[model samples]
Target: MMQRFIPLGNGYSDIYELMYIGRAMPERVRHMLVLHPFDENNPEASLALVMKPTNPGNFQPIYICLEGVPIPSKRYDLWRELADELQHDVIELTVSPSGKFSDQEIFFQHLIGILRTNHYLPRLQRSF
Candidate 1:
């Protein structure tokens, strides 16, 4: 199966759109994740939605807002809203900030590693 990250703009007003997708596609929803990065100086958070492979295409999509929001420790309401809308538990993972990586590819590679380690994502060469 093929997998990729689809970026959604920050959690300003787009959050409603994100909620709509989760509520509308409950069957396709695989997991909801909150990624937090805490560096000595910089702290950030991102929300992501993982979906099951589509029929006939076998493509899995991971929708992400990237490191656009401040840490949820300061804004728990967003997390609560997301949990309520998805009607499922949200998994939280601490990871290195994307800014640490020189390129977007490297950042996503790091994310994939974290997801794999947590069993949220399939292992390399494993078919979905």
Candidate 2:
């Protein structure tokens, strides 16, 4: 199975698009996540949704809006509300900021490891 992060753009207005996916395809939503890559003093956050793997392709896509919105903002509230309506609890975690990595790919790789280790995402199966 292959796992990937598909960025939806910075939270700003793009958050609506993320919400729409959750509402339109509620069954595909596996998890809702809020990643805080900085200290508590920082108010910005990243939102993400992990979707169930595709049937034919076995591709698990994690949609994200990397650290772009403030925690108490309307967008963040809307995300939480969507999760509630979908009966999914938002999972929050503190992680190293994406800026620490050389590129977005590396940053997502780091997050994948964390999600797997924490049992939020499935471990990769080895093929003999």
Tens-place lDDT digits, model 2, residues 1-128: 89999999989989999888889889999999999886655568999999999999899999998899797888888998998999999999999888778988999999999999999999998778
* Number of the top-ranking candidate, with lDDT as the measure: 2
What TM-score would each prediction reach against the true structure? Answer: 0.84, 0.95
Candidate no. 2 TM-score: 0.95
TM-score of 1: 0.84
Give, for candidate 1, the lowest lDDT window spanning 10 residues.
71-80
Query: lDDT per residue, candidate 1, 44-75, as tens digits?
Result: 57888889878988788888877766764534
Look at candidate 1 and tell me the lDDT of residue 126. 64
Off by over 4 Å in 1: 73-76, 126-128
The local distance difference test score of model 2 is 0.91
Candidate 2 runs further than 4 Å off: 39-42
